[model samples]
Each structure stands twice: as structure tokens, then as C-alpha cells.
Target chain A: MWDYSETVKEHFFNPRNAGAVADANAIGEVGSLSCGDALRLTLKVDPATDTIQAAGFQTFGCGSAIASSSALTELIKGMTLDQALHVSNQDIADFLEGLPPEKMHCSVMGREALQAAVANYRGEVWQDDHEEGALVCKCFAVDAVLIEETIRANGLSSVEAVTHYTKAGGGCSACHEGIEEILTRVLAEQGKTFDPAAAPPPADKSGSAGARLGTLARIRRIEHAIEAIRPNLQRDHGDVELVDIDGKNVFVNMTGACAGCQMATTTLEGIQQRIVEDLGEFVRVLPAQAMPQTTNNQ
Target chain B: MTQAPAGIYLDNNATTMVAPEVVEAMLPYFTEQFGNPSSMHQFGDRVGRALKTARQQVQALLGAALDSEIVFTSCGTESDATAILSALKAQPERREIITTVVEHPAVLSLCEHLEKEGYTVHYLRVDRKGRLDMQQYLDALSSKVAIVSVMWANNETGTLFPVEEMAELARSAGVMFHTDAVQVVGKIPIDLKRSAIDMLSLSGHKLHAPKGIGVLYLRRGTRFRPLLRGGHQERGRRAGTENSASIVALGKACELALAHMDAEKTQVRMLRDRLERGILAQVPNAFVTGDPSNRLPNTCNIAFEYIEGEAILLLLNKAGIAASSGSACTSGSLEPSHVMRAMDIPFTAAHGTTRFSLSRYNTVADIDRVIAAVPPIVAQLRRLSPYWDASAGAPLAEPETAFQPAYA
Candidate 1:
């Protein structure tokens, strides 16, 4: 089961604006029954002030889609047309506390319908169609621009947040590394940098010169060498992620089908040791578990 | 979850409980009359007579002219494979097969594998209610078509297909026709002699007999090949040890079906209708799938648009009410059912599709329990959704019409 947030669950169960509108200003219908979910959103707009006076919806969908419509109605009621138009899918998700990463698209659908409804009210087309952009998640039809924009707007601090916003790396997970790279590039473009060196140093480092390769220059050298070896490991049905470096011990996390395989220890001993040796004898390569559980958990 | 005093057996479509009469008829086979039907001894000859009597009972139920046409197999899937493979083998020159989109996986997957092996396979589309398009089916049938396979009734939606007409069309084109009548047998009348159907398959479990027993009826003079190759247990058509006990049980079950056909048609239909109407009326946005006019008297496929079928099934199981989902086979994938997709049913509604197949054991009270329990569960799942806001129930004005030309 998808780990739906309490707020999402609350809105789903007790949806605010369910049913059809009797006399509404503009209505929008998005998605199809064949597509697995459909929504019929009706709005009663105040023509004098151009504000949404009332909203009602009749959705033929799952709990998430219904809740998304319900949350959308609640967000738009009493708000001006412009305010309602700016009510992003992210805002809807946040308003509902949080939604399952996969069902985030349902919230996005709600937002799309709202924009289309508002456009209908203005008697104009809402043309945000940048179809030529690179596809971010093909399964959900999400694009790269949308993912980057969502990340920037939401202050997403982790890969999980990016998943919640754009639904990237959720399906197939073949694009997880690409999503991570895009996220990192987006963060860099925004002048935000993540430096592992900024973390507090470990306290129990009382060892000889062989174990005391803690100089910043040595650390940078090891980082460069590990980066060079990363691609080769990835090609051999494995991935190497930096856990944390404490003194001469360079910690890396191996993943994929290799994570818990019988060959994992051999990989660490032979493959990882050779890479570490290339960096210098001072550097000791270790698995992620070599560090204390509490220290690594962070 | 309310626990019943005894374990409620609600998955009747999967298998059914053996009626008392069927069990009594099989008692002698398990003990007193344990003899090989093929043996030359007097005891074996008596067992052979019993087998002949059973064959006649099966023939009478199916409305077939002769008992020789009915060839007993080990199971439904095996019978289905036998029918399709036999058609392909007999007409080796014709490498094309045509079937409907809503056929059970037993047929659909086999056709798919055949396509991978350089054979052309056409899957005719079905409407939203799971009805096949006859014109499209007829168009797909050609001289190159080896067989045209279609199900008599859909297991999920209970929608009846025009099998007789389809069979006639296939026969006119000199192609074989097969129907997996597993869901329809004993529930509806089937006249094999009157229809142009060349082969038909039926399973024992669906009609309250033990599993591992099935029957395939091949029309006389129809070109065919046996699927199995070993000792000739089923007249060299199916080889291996005979499931004598289960076959006896199935024969008795067929007898009971023939005796109780009239009452089953009326009573089960009434219970099914009541269940369908009650659920639709009580729940918001709930609707039934399949042709309302032509359907199984004891089956209803409903979509309570929003809640997942697994959640509903779990809740129903807790309440001692059994049900199945159209998306049950594709569970964990979160994809809407392939059947619903082919029919153009919306994905949101497709995930919510549930099937309730009734039997003689079900009562009006059972339907009432289902009607009472399902709405609340739908409401509960809807509440957890971010899409619905319960507090915003105030009425809104109707939107002005923005009518576009219907053709455009």
C-alpha cells in the first residue's frame, strides 16, 4: 500500500465539495473514465469581483482523485480568480498534508482542471503547453522543466521530495540516477550546494599516520579517485554511493542486485580495495556498515 | 473485521462446495466400486458402464447429440489448451487466430504466445460493458484463420457474447470455432448440436464439482489432434491416470444442474438483481458493468469509483461476504484492469471494479449484508483521499454552456 499522509486520508474520507453544481459560471472536465479516473468540476464564480463564490465536483475516480478534487474546491472557494489559478498541485498536496508519490499526479490533475476551469471562465485558452521539453517521467508524462520548477518552489531537500512532486523515479526506477542528476543540476542552478565536508568530524580518531589521513587534500584526492571508479562499478550491476568519510576510512554504499548478494564481500575486498589502493595506502576502503549504525544513519 | 462462526466460503467462482447428492454418488467409487474402467474383468466392465452413464449425463446437460463428443480432461486450462492446439495442428496451413479482448487469461495468454511464434492473432475490442463487436470479429475472420476463439460469458463482467453467430461466421469461412464456456456452463443453457461451435470447454469446479476435472466437447468429423501423448486414458486424446473420483462427482453435479435448472435461473437472477440495484442505489457513483439485458443470472460487476478493489475485497472478507476484482490479477501493479481498459472504462473506476458471483448457497440476506457493508467502506476509502473535501458540500451554481459541435 502507498504510504498516504494523514491529511490526504482525512480529505479523501471527508471530501469537502462532492456532487454537481446546479448553477455554476464555468465547468471543466479533465481525464477520462477509460484513463482510470475522471473529474467533473463545477464552479460558481462572482462575475462582479472575479472571485470563486462556490465550487462542487462529481469525480469518477479512486480515493486520491476524489480527495484531490475536494481539496481543490476547498482551496479555491472565496479566493480571487488569480489566487485560484496560482494554486499549484504542490499546494493541494501540502494542504492535504501529503500524498503517496504515485498519486501525486491525481493532485496535479485537479490543478490542471482548475486552471482549465478558470480559463473557460475568462473565455481564453490556458496555453502552458511546452510539449517539446525533455520527458522526465515517461510513464506519467512529466517533463524535466516541471520537476525542476517543482523542486525550486517546494524547497525539496531530498530525493523523496522530488518523487512526491514530479513522480519521477517512482515507476521502473530506471531513471532514478537521471532524476538525481537533474535535481542536483537544478539545485546548482539555484546556487544551492550540498557539501559532505560540512558535517561534524568523528571524535574517536586516535591512530598512527597510516590511519590519520584526515587532511582535506587527501580527502579530496580520495573523492576524485572514487568518482573515477564509480562508473565501472555501476556497469557491473552495482552502484557506489558515498556514505561518509572518517579519517582514512572511505565509506561507500553499494546497491542494486549486488547489495545483499553473496559476491558483495568479494566486491568490497577486491574491487573496492584496488580503487582505494590507487588513491594511496593511507586510504582504507570500507563498506557502509564499518561505521557505527547511529553515525551512518544520518 | 467480524469473524463468522464457520469459515465462509465465498470464492465460488474459484471453486464451489460439493452438494450432498454429488458426494453420495461418488462414495462407491472411492471404496466399493474401485475398479479400472479399461480392465476386461466383470468389476472393470461394471465401472466402464458407470463411466458410460456419466458421459451420457454430461451429454444431456450440454445438449450434445452423442456422448462420444465429450472428452474429459484434467482441468479447464488443459481443455482450453487442447482445443486451441488441436485447431492449430489440424489446420497447419492457416496460421491466424482471432479472439475477443475480454477472454479469460487461459485463452488470451495462449493466443499471445502463439503470436510470438510467428502466428497472426487478432484481439477484437469490447465495449465498456465488455460486449464484443460482431462486425469487427467477422472482419478479422478470413480463410487464413485457423480458429476463432471466444468465451460464452466473461468471468469478470458476466457479459454474454453472441457465440452461435460467431461460430456460424467461422464455419462459413471454413475455420474452427472454440468457446471457453467455463463461466457459462450449468448457469446458462448451451445447445452444442444447434450451435456451429466446433469445440467447447468446461471446468468442474465452477459447477460445484472437485478441481482437476474438466470436459471438452468436439463436434463429430471436426479435424483435431490430441494435446497429451502417453497411455490412452481418455480414448488416446488425453493420456495418464484418470481422476475417477472427481469425474464421478462432476457427473453427479451435472445431473443436479439439469434437475435444478429452472429454480436456479429464477432465484439466482432475483438475488443478483436485488444485490446490484441495492448497491447502486445506496452508494454514490456506483454502477454495474456489462450488458444489463444479457448477463449471467447470478453475477454482477460493479465499480464504486474511487476505492481500490483489494481494499473492498478485504473488507467484504472480514464481513463474510466474498467478492473478486477485475484488477485482481494485476494487483500490486496499480494498473486498471486490461478488460476495463479495452472497454474504455475510466482508470479511476476500473481500479474499483468488483465482481460478485452468486450461487445456490447465497441468500437474499447475504446480498443485504453486502449492500449494507460496501457503501461505508467506499465512504471510508473516499475519506482518506486528498481529492475529496467533505466540508465543502454547499451547493454551487451551474456553469454556462460552452457547447461545441458534437461532430467536431
Candidate 2:
């Protein structure tokens, strides 16, 4: 459980200005039920003063989210629309005394809603054409545009921080790689470089000779290694065929003397070690009988 | 000052208060009987006797034929690891595992690790009611499977799985079967002699015993490998000196559980039903999450539409009532629990799921307090919710493909 501050709990329990202003002129809406949080900010602006006369919110989320939205209303009220535009999510969190790192997205939602409200007041677009960007987090419905915005706004370098700021990688985590890619690109655009080492090891697509060989070529290489070792195995009246190759897995069928042999494990290990020595470290040779083979052998 | 006031606790599935008898049973071991059971002195003799009695107590509760079959470990996770890893090590030829998608993190996370280590894991799916498909399970028990590990009852939903029948099926296929019965041990009756479960895992804390102690029940002559290899504690099946105090407490807890088992099903079931019925009557757009008739007696998982759970929980906390949620906000994740997601519960409702688990210590007044405190809270949150439609009993703007089941 989070060690939420008293102020946060108070604001969440008894939120100030917690309903849509029926007579409000400028309105902003962000997030969705699918994202697990949403906020609708209604602002009544005094046209003569160009200031926010009243602010109200309808939030669909957690305690911290409601508190953030409530805090946003208090912070932006009685301020010029221009001044309210500069109220960051950090400022909302600060008003609540603080939010948990994981709940920081609640404050971010408040900031986004404020931006949208101000944009509506100015009759300007709040963000780029979000539809043009591809969806990155299907679970939260967070798209690349939102991910990039959060990454740049917070200078986020890690997937965890991105989740806290935008809730992009906080779901099934299937979109972490996509989030990392966006973070790298956005940081690069800002003339800042993310530490690649801090990220998960990239899929081995370095095009090194051993790593780049096509599946058929890799299979051929394994067969060649088997041919070299066949003479020694034939001395024991045993011959092995390349039954299948699946990623790092190499399936081999041992016939004649090797079939149902008591030394099958030893021979399989010997064959696997020999392949690793001849082919690469990623290769793992197993007896075809050990696992049901997915590939057919000629 | 931020500490929550003493209040009604309906989150027993998360952890239970240590029973007074269990605490009394453990007090002696902490000071008077502090000797290591492994030592060759008189002090060790007394400690060893206490350990034996504790094992017997747990054995009696589980209806295992012998006390020696039980091996104590640090917690449920350790017990689960010890059993599953032992099966893999004992049967090195088999490379496949069978488990459900709704298992606790102790089993799910371990299966993920095993998969990374090249073991194929077949995650059995559950129906909308969170019940397993028998045909899917039986078909998964092929010759390639080393072990079948499934939880007896789901922690979040309280839905019980047909583990005894599943274990029998695995036994016929010559496959090892293990059940993480941490949630079921105290609440339900378990007889290893009558069941085909080769191994079972139980945690002390879930059964009113203190934390830091768990048990792995291995049927006699079951081939096994120790997860922690060192000293000859637990008859060489587990290493390191015994946690003498917690072991004694667990034994006392098991005895208490066995004594209260009948009342738990009767009185506790009554209290749970009262809360469920009351809430359903008071709150609009609320429904149960699992097999209503087949779940554990003390558990009730209800989902409220149009309002998230954390907001509800916070209001409840202010009212001096405590519960838990499968909500993304509570879990510190962007999605709700995997159990709810696997059931394909509508995202709008899933985010609002809350679990109220009761214990024997609770009273009817506690239930009454919760029933009264909850309706107003839900009403307030719904009023503040943008999706809520006061006239219609649903969200005003439901997602395009929320997958609302007929029952929902």
C-alpha cells in the first residue's frame, strides 16, 4: 500500500469543486475508462479578466487521481488562463504534499486536462494529430504521441518512469519495447541520449555472421557439423540426422545403435557441445524423441 | 498520526490476524525452547519433540496418513518452488508443465521462470465464472508433462478448482501433481490419503498462524529434490535450522482451523451472505465476480460499475472499514488482476472490483457496519464519476468492445 500523505487523503475524500460546471464555457476531457483513469475539467472563465473564475472536475479513477484533479481545480482557479497553462503535474502533486511514484500518472492526467482546457479556450489544438501516431499500449490505449509527450515532458529514461508519467508500460507490459523505442527517439530529438545498457538486452539482430545466418543456412551448418562427427559415431554403429532447427533448439534423430540407447543423454550432450563449438553458443541440440519435433527432416 | 484506526478488517485473504492460541503456542519456543532442533543436547530434544507435535497437528488437519510427509519452509512461495522444481529435477526427461492462468504470483511467476529455462508451460484457461475446463485440463496431461500445479482456490476470486480430480488424472498419466492450497487449507477440508495430489503447499499466515512458515506435503515415496540444499533439517528435504517458533504456531493454527472448520462454513458463510445480499440490495449496478455458489464461504468479490475501486476503498478507510481490490490503482499497475482479465470481465467493471474476505474473528456488527458504510460511498463516487449515468444502471460511455457477458 502507498504511504499517502494526510493532505492527499483529505483532498481525495472531500474533493473541492468535484462536479462539471453546468455553465462552464471552456471544457477539457482526457483519458478513458479503458485506461483505468479519466478526467473532465470544466472551467468558467471571466472573459473581461481572461482568468479562470471557477473550476470543477469529474474524475473517474483512484484516490490519488481524484485528489490530483481536485488539486488541479484549486491551483488553476482565480488565475489567468495563461498562468493556468503553466501549471505542471508536478505542481498538482506538490499541492497534495506528494503522490506515490506509481500514482504520478494521476497528476499527469491533471496537467493534460488543464492543457486541453486552455487549448479549448484559445481555440487551438491541444496536441498533435494523435490519430496519425500508432497505438503503442493496447491495454491502456496509450498511443505513441502520448508516450513521446510524457517522455519529453518528464525527461523519462526508463520504462517504469514512462508508466508512472503516462501509464504506457504499466499494463501487460507487452508494449515496453515500443515504449523504449519511443523514449529513445524522443530523447534523441531533445539532444539527450538514454543509456541503452539500462534497457533490456535488444533482440540479437546485430547481423554478426553466426547471428545473421538464415534458418536454412543455420540448418545446413548444423548438418555439416554432424557430417564431420558422423565417422566417430559410426564407429559405434550410430548415425544422427538433423531432424529440426527451431531458433536455438536443434532436434536430432539418433538411429540404429543410438535408438533407445542407455547412453542417449551422453551422446545428445556430446552432439550439443560439438555443435556449440562448430556453430555458435545459441545452439542447443536435443534428441528428437525428447521433445515432439515441429519441423520435418528430409 | 497516519496510522489507520483499529477498524473492521474484511481483507483476510491478504493476511489474517494471528490467533491468540497460535501465538500462545509459539511463545515458549521463542525463549524457553530456543535450542536448534538439529543439536545433540537435551534442549534440542525438547525442541525436536515440539517440532514433531507441530507436524502431527498439521498432519491431522490435512488428513495425511503420516506427519513425516510434511516439510516446513520459509513461506508459500518457497514451498511451491520446492515442489515444482523437485518434480522437474526428479523427472528430468519431461519438459512440460500444466497450470492455470489464474494462479497466485507464487505459482505464475515461477512458471514464467521455468518457461525461460526451456520448460514449456501450458496455461489452462478459465471460463467467465473462473472455473476450469475439464477437457482442456485432461488433454494437457500428456507424456511430456513433468508436473501439473494448480491452486486449490484462487486468492482473488475465492473460486475453488477441481484439483483432486485433476490430480487423479495427472496420476493416471504418471505425472507429478502439486496444489498451492495456501488459501484452501484452513477454509476447506483436505485429505491427501483420499486425494491423488502428490504434493501440496500451504502458508501459515493465511490460516491465522504467523508469517515466515509454510509446509510442503509430499506423499510418501514421492521422488523429490530440495530447493534449499544444506543441513539435514526437514529430513534432508529442506535445509537450514528449523524456524521452531513459527512451526509450533503453524501447528496450533492448524488445530484451531480444524476445530473451527465446520463453524467457518456455517456461521462465516452466513455473515458473508448477509454482506453480499445487503450490498446487492443497497448498491445499484453491482454483481459478484466468481461462481457465486461454489466459492469459499468467507470470500465475496463484487464489482461496481462506473466507479473505480481505489476511490471506494479510500472512502471505506475513512469510515473505518478495510477491504481490497483487483483494481489497477490498488495493484500499482495499469490493468486489473490477471485473474479478472483472463475471465474477460468488461474493463469498465473490472477496474471497480473489490474483494471482501472475512475471518472467524469478525462479527455480524462488522458486516452491518460495512453494509451501511458502502452504499453512501458508492453513491458519492458515482455522482463524481463522468461515465456514470444516474438514470441508466450502466456507464454512459461504455467502450466499443467491453465484452459484457450475459450474466453481467
Candidate 3:
């Protein structure tokens, strides 16, 4: 469970400005029932003053999400639409002292609702639903446009970090590659490397989580190295299937013409060298047939 | 603004409080009787004797013909992994696993990993009331299947499965059968001698034992291959030094559990029913989930429409009540529990499920506190909910869903 702050708990137990604002002119809806969370934000804006006279919300999510929405309503009530538009997700999280990295997406949802509401006031298109060629995560319906914007705003550098911010790769995990591409491109634009393995892990009590992530990152690097070799094999009407990665051994299957070819040994050596170069660690690429069956399950 | 108050635990399905008697039974092993059971010295012999008694105690509870069938492991996950993996290893030709979608993660996750390792797993479906599709289970059984692992009781819904019948069907097909009876063991009577169950897995913590001790009941004469290989611990079925203190605690806990098993169906059931009825009577649009008539006596899973479960849990926590939920918010994965999803519960109620699992330790006061504390919290969250407005109109359950099953 998240170690939520007292203020977060306070706002959750006693939310402010709940329900639809009476005679509200601007309304923003974000999230969906299928995604397991949704928010409807209504703003009572004074046209003459260009300020939000009142704000109310209806949120269907976890405790942190509810608290974040409550805090967002409290933060935006007295601000002009222009000023409220500048309220970042970080600001919402800061208002709550902090939300767990796993729950930072709640604050992001609050920011998205604000942007959508302000756009509603201006009669502008606020794309929260899936757009043509824009959806990146089909499971959660997260879009690349929103993913890019969130990555830039939060300075997220890892796929997991992006998930904690936008919930892009939190479901099915098929979109992790899509999220990784966006994170790399955005972090590159910021002149930063998207390597969470090198960065200090968030202050979670699970002290070994950072080292565990390092292992995961290394495994991902190994998988990518094999992927890079796939095109080389595919060009010759043959394919290599990654069977298993057991410690320093990378078990793979060379199917099609490459299966029993005389050059298989040299090919395995080449793959082994590529893995070593890519990971800066020793590893042997052995054929799947050579994988010993004695390695029992535990 | 008030500090959290004294907690009334109703999350026994998650884990139970260790009984004081069980703790006392374990204390001497931790401090004085510390020698290894395998050691040859007198101190070790004494501990080894205790270990034998512990095994018999566990055996008596499980009603296994022999104490040797009980292979102690680190936890229920290990026990489950051992039973399933050993089944597959015992029959190298069979590359498939048959299990239910509503299984605890211990079995479901292992099956998933096995799938990646080139194993075909058939996750049989469950109906809306948490009943497994018997036709689906029968169809999924074949020569390619190595084992059929089903839970005796679901952790979330407390709905009982027809494991005895399932085991019989599997045996006729010449396939091994295992039941994750972790939630069912102490809550109900088990006479394993008369059953066709080939293996069973259970945890200590679920039945008032200290954590880290579990039993993988491998029926005698079942072909076995150990998941953990090492010294001849658990008669070469499991490895590593025995968790002496916890094992002793589990033995005592099992004995105590056997003594109070009847109370679970009576006293605990009464408290559970009262809490369920009180909450449903006052909280509109709330209905129970799972097998209505065939559920465990101590579990109540209610879905309060329009309010998210985490919000309910947080407010319940403030009221000094402890329960669990099937909502995605509580799960590490950003989806509702697969059990809930497999049952095809609508999004409206799926995100709103709150589970209150009781144990024999609970009293009328605890149930009364939960009953009194829950109605307002649901109301408050509903009032805060955007869908609850009269103008918007709360999305009510279909008549079929609102027909609360015969369950608590």
C-alpha cells in the first residue's frame, strides 16, 4: 500500500468541491471506465474576470487519485484559466507533499483534466479519446501525443517511470516498446540518456529494487542485441528465436535454412560476441538443443 | 484530522493473526530447542522428536494417511510451485497445465511462467457467480495435460470449488490433480484419505500459523520430482534447513484450528452474515459477489455501486476497520482482479468490490463496528461521486445482478 501523506488522506477522507459545479460552463472529462479510473471536472468560470469561480470533480479511481482530484479542485478555484493551465502535475503532487511513484499518474490525471477543462472554456479540441494514429497503449488507451507531453513535463526517463506518470505501459505490457521509444526521443531532446539503471531509484524501502532493475535493464539490453541480429538473419530467409537467458548463457534456436547449417557455430560465436559487446559482460550464445534439461524448476 | 484508531481486522483471507497459543508453542524452539532436526546430538534428537509430532499434527489436520506426505516448504508459493512443477517433471511428455482463471497468483503466475517456457496452460473460465464451467474443465482435460490445479476456495470471494469431483475426473483421465487448499484447510474439514486429490498446497499464515511455513501434501505413491534439490530434508522432497520455530507454530496452529473448525461455520459465520446484511440493507445499489449458497461461511464480498473500492478502504481504515478489495487500485497491475474480470463483473461494480473476510477470532463487536462504519462511508463516497447525482442518475445494476445470490 502507498504511504500516503496526512494531507492526502485528509483530502481523501474529506474532499473539497465534490459534485458538479452548479451552472458550470466549462467541463473536462478524462480517463475511462475500462481503464479502471475516470474523472469529470467541472469549472464555474467568471467570464468577466477570466477566473475560475468554483471547481468540482467526480473521480473514479484509488484513494490517491481521489485525493489528487480534490487537491486539484482546491488549487484551481481561485486561478484564472491561463494560470490554472500552468499548474503542472508536479504542483498537484507537491500540494499533497508527495504521492508514491507508482501513483504519480493520479496527479498527471489531474493536470490532464485541467488542460481539458481550460480547452473546453476556449472551445478548443481537447483530445482525450483515442485519435487516429495517435494511440500508443491500446490497453489503457494512452496516446503518443499525451505520452510525449507527459515525458517532457515530468522529465521521465524510464518506461516504468512513464507508467507511474501516465499508465501507458502498466497494462498488458505490449506498449512498453512504444513507451520506451517515446521516453528515449523525449529524453534525447532534453540532452539526457534514458537509463533508469544508471539513475538512483526512488526512495522506496525495497533497497534491492534498484539492483533488480539494473538486472532487468541488462536483460532488456540483451534482448535488443538479439533483436538487432534478427534482421540480419531475416534477410537470408532464416530466423533466430531467443529460447531462454540462463545466467551467462543465451539459448536461441536457428530455424529455417540456418537450423543445421555448417556455419551455425560461427553464427553462434558472432551472436555471442555481439552480446558481450552490447552488454559489456560475458555471455555464450548456445543452440536451444544444447540447453540442459537438468536445470530443475524451483 | 484524527489519528487512526484501533484496527478491527476483517481481512483474514489475506492473512490471519497468529494465535497466542501458537506463538507460545514456537517460542522454545526459537530460544532453546535450536538444534537442527537432522543433527545427531540429544538436543537435535529432542528437536527432531518435536518435528515428528509437528508432522503428525499437520497430518491429522489434513487427514493424510501418512505424515510423510507433508513436505514442508518456505511458504504456500513454494508449496504450490513444488506441487505443480513436480507434476510436470514427473511426466515429461505432457506439456500442458489445466487450471482455473480464478486461482491465487501462486498457481496462476507459475502457470504463466510455464507458458513462456513452452507449456500450454488452459485457464478454465468461471461463471458470474464464481462457479467454474464444469464443461470447460472437462473439455480442457486431455492426454497432453500433466496436471489440473484448482483452488478449494477463492481468496477473494471465498466461493468453494468442487475440487473432490474435479480430482476424480482428472484421475480418470490419468492426470494428476492438485488443490490450493490454502484458504480452505482450517476453514473447513478435509478428509484427504477418502479423496482422489494427488497433491495439495496450504499455508500456515492463512490458518493462524506463523508465516514462512507451508505444506505441500504429496499423496504417497505419487511420482515425485523435487522443485528444490539439496540435503534429504522432507524425505528428499524439499531442501534447506527446516524452519523449526515456524514449523512448530504451524503444528500448534493446525491443532488449534482443528479444535475451532466448527466455530468458523457457526460463530464466525454469524458475524459475517450480520456484517453483510447490515451493509447491504443500508447501502443502496450494493450486492454480493460469488457463489451465493456455496461460499465459505466467513467471507462477504459486496460491491457498492458508483464508489471506487480504494476510497472505501481508506475511509474504512480511518474508522479503524481493515478489509480488502478486488479493485484495480489495490492490485499492483492496473486492472481489476482477473477473478473479477473472468466472472464478467461490470466495470461499475468491479471497481467497487470490498471484501470482508472473517476468522474465528472475530467477535460480534467487530462485525457491529464494520456494519456501522460502512454505510456512511459508502454514502459519502457515492455523494462525492459524479454519477450519484439525481440529475445524472446513478447507474443501477441490472435486475439479474441486483438479485443477490443466496450467498452472504
Better of 1 and 3 by lDDT: 3
Off by over 4 Å in 1: A1-298, B1-3, B6-11, B27-35, B40-47, B328-330, B392-408
State the lDDT of candidate 3 residue by residue for A43-162, as single tens digits.
999999989999999887789889999999999989999999988887898899988755666787888888888888889978654321246775555677779988788566778666
lDDT of 2 by residue, B124-162 (tens): 999999999888888888999999999999998899998
- Clashing residue pairs for model 3: B292-B407
Instruction: State the lDDT of candidate 2 residue by residue for A251-281, as single tens digits.
Output: 8899877787655665676677557655655
Top model number, lDDT = 2
**How are the candidates ranked when ordered by DockQ, highest leading?**
2, 3, 1
CA lDDT of every candidate: 0.73, 0.84, 0.83
Q: Report backbone clashes per prediction.
A: 44, 0, 1
Best by DockQ: 2
Give fnat of each prediction, in order. 0.11, 0.51, 0.43
Across A95-152, the per-residue lDDT of candidate 1 in tens digits comes to 8886665566667778877877888888977554422234556454456667777778
Per-model TM-score on C-alpha atoms: 0.62, 0.76, 0.76
